[model samples]
Target chain A: MSLDDLYQSIILDHNRRPRNQGPLEGADREVHGHNPLCGDQVTIRLKMDGTTITDVRFEGSGCAISRASASMMTSAVKGRTTAQALTLFDNFHELVTGAPPAGTKLDGNAGTPGMSNASGESTDVKMPRELAAFAGVARFPLRVKCASMAWHALREALVG
Target chain B: MHRSDFPLLAASPGLHYLDSAATTQKPAVVLDAMREFYETSNANPHRGAYELSGRATDRYQAARERVARFFGLGDPDCLIFTRGTTEALNLVAQAWGRRELEPRDEVVITAMDHHANFVPWQQIAIATGARLRICELTPDGRLDMDHMRELIGPRTRVVAFPHVSNALGTVNPVADIVALARDAGALTVCDGAQAAPHMPVHFDTLGVDLYAFSGHKICGPMGIGGLLGRRTVLESLPPWQHGGDMIQVVQDEFSSWNVLPHKFEAGTPNVADAVGLAAAVEYVDGIGLDTILAHERHLLALATDRLAAMDGLTIYGPPAAERSGVLSFTMADVHPHDLATILDADGVCIRAGHHCAQPLMRRLHVPATARASFYLYNDESDVDALMRGLQRAAALFAVAGSASD
Candidate 1:
């Protein structure tokens, strides 16, 4: 019963009907990320319009957290600049891992300011509401990798 | 069951541990033996000249003798102590494989083997320019004997396989396979990491040229294991590691290696864990290996029956009669990782991954599986808890208006 915090309705919904869940046709950049420990793999494909990600899609098989994260990630990063998506990755990472990416500040615009962390205390950077469903991942340390599998692939695809 | 003998199981009344294939819980006797060794005979073995060092050497030698006797080996000098099965296999692969295998030589392995048994041979094959051939598995998860007979030929120099598959729990016919290798003039290396714990394993009877097993998997302490090699085979290879203990004469330009087991065991050996492993062997012997095997078979049957009756679950491996003590499966809607998490919430521990048999998982067409392995400590209640937890995972993922909905 206590697993409700980790597996929210919205997350499960996205997992059941994943958006952008197939290979993107005419995609310019594609990157595959796999966690050899769990065998969770995510392939992120992007159709980049200059510096802007005009279209994004994913293809892979994994747990609900990873699948749903990839589903929500595609919708969240579509039509966004490469810089904005990287910023969102930082915020999403901090939300689940309880720590921001090393050597980078969480510049505003990833979430609503002054949102509460898992302990009901206000945090410096807030997470987008849909991504906030994964904040409970911080409690279950092992699932953090599952939550961030897609985000890591996206970061790799963008930077490379 | 002998659950009470293990301190951790005795302390945690609510824990239902089904992950013995990863490593078993150490009993109090094994712990006490290590503590006793440290308290009384604490000194570096084979070096010190004082009385304490003599006692330490005696303890270490006595452990080797106990281990040799337990595994039905005639010569204790053939047993080389290692950190675990990984190191032992690496030693064989590096020392024997590098020296014996020529560019056109062939090495045979099975697809269902754990990476410990598979990778070392792969690396050695690459290093030596030898051909690495893998024996395929049957649909029921047993090794395809036809494929094996085809792979092992005149050029096959070394054949390595697991006695019991860590992922599928398929118990291999060790002596039969060893005979095939012998007929082909190839040395056989058997990885007994998964088999030595739940069942009786006799090195001399198995007829394998080299055998490796881990202490932690056999309810012994970690960081200590033994590689049992034939006397002639052990003498034919070079020493794996160099330094303190494995030398006979150190010259300015060249050095001569020690004989038999000492030639393989270099540096300060893990004396205390070795003593602990011997005590573990004694404790297991006290319980009777036949009784342990029977108990685990009963548990495995119960688990298999329950899991088979479950609507959405599909169990891997051969029939319950063919398997040792492991049950690997997958649910329809829930991922293995998610299923493991749900089971853990109910204090039921199961392993969920590729189980270090990535090639086997690929052959099975599943990325990973959920495995629940039985041991001497487990009983019917543990199986019941596993069922309850699996049902919880199913309901959470499938039922309308449930948490997922």
Candidate 2:
């Protein structure tokens, strides 16, 4: 609702110095996404070995929210499998769009729908704490697109 | 002008509305006229045989006449009521562009035009297999007339440009462009959406084949605008939309069109909004367009000086003397969306985006810019509020950086 809530220190730091900010060599897939409304654009590249994402990177020019989201997404999904990365993307998207986590009781799923932790406990129906910084985006409807721009490209890069 | 004359401004006291280039706040007189029309004559014009319908028809036609006189058109019938400038431009593209353009023909448009003026021509060119050529802008955002001259050749079928840029507020050289188009035997379509509200527009003297302007940008109701064209040119083109009221006689398979303006207008028109637009025209005329232009220029000068004095701020567009009432700028390391959000918290409304001119954004090498536009209602205090809001955003960002460090 306020600027402080949306522009958290974590978001600003990632925007200032994004991780994996450039191209990924010998990538398996590369996809581009752009928000025509604000002219924010991101190109996401991925390197997949079998069903596992070995590396991921992105490059673009946009607002702090979009840049930070892209930087955070690349860092979160780099070492995870394709399936795990996609699930994480879904959880992050829901967190920013104000939707309940996917495959939760509210989503009418019989079983939890996320990856297991080291203790073999199901961590479904909860967004990773790192992505909680973006929860404020839901209040500013116009900025939801900024938070989701990179994830959209990631979805396309993985699926298509 | 007293802000109390506008109901919305009166209700939202201390609200700084700097987005008038996007749409102006409506005056009480225009609102009252529209309400009175609905209360007194609610019948469908040119439909019923009763006196109410006759009165409605008279009122609608009288609106057309008033709009014509406001734009300096001799024949009211040459002006056709439309949904807005976008629809008017689309009408020209579909009706005129489809018929006149052919394969290998060129339709020249500028890089600074709003999407309403750019996209319709681009679509028409694609449909007809004609080439869509774009005129570039100078480094300072003015239209590159030399490049425009080079682009307008014998194959150019039409030249469409904006009278004033919605994004950069660059006042184009209309007479020169019109003369070049005429010499090249190309029809000229001037998108006057930004011009009519800020200055006096004479459609006939401009020598354009067609001119389009919206009502909402001129302090009138939305969903209404006017397209002024020469009688011969309007009659030559086929009807863009086919429906009731635009047909003279219809068989099971064939139909003949109506007269000049009516042929372009299909179905029941926006009668109430048209009446509101007429009232808007009268209201501005009462204040004198020249005076409004001067007031806006003064505001623009004051705002430009203040913005220029700011650290790490870059203002877009030509100088104040050459432009209208728009001021687009960018602050150091701060996105326009962030600036707009900060300004909104202080009750200052501004537009921060490509302003529907993405091509110009690319030309400027910026993703987007924050724009503050002035109108009749905006004064010096509004500009001061904008500056204060921007300063607050800068201070916040600076503090956040230092805290993180």
Best DockQ among the predictions, by candidate number: 2
Model 2: per-residue lDDT, tens digit, B2-114? Answer: 68889999999879999999999999999999999999987888899999999999999999999899999998999999999999999999989888889999999999989
Worst 10 residues of 2 chain B by lDDT: B396-405
Worst 10 residues of 1 chain B by lDDT: B396-405
lDDT of each: 0.90, 0.89
Write down the RMSD of candidate 2 (Cα, Å): 2.7
Candidate 2 residue spans exceeding 4 A from truth: A101-127, B403-405
Model 1 segments more than 4 A misplaced: A106-127, B400-405
| Candidate 2 structure, TM-score to reference | 0.94
What is the per-residue lDDT of model 2 for residues A27-51, given as tens digits with 9 covering 90 to 100?
A: 8899999998888899999998876
Interface RMSD (Å), every candidate? 2.9, 1.5
DockQ of each: 0.46, 0.58
TM-score of each: 0.96, 0.94
Error of 1 at B13 (Å): 0.8
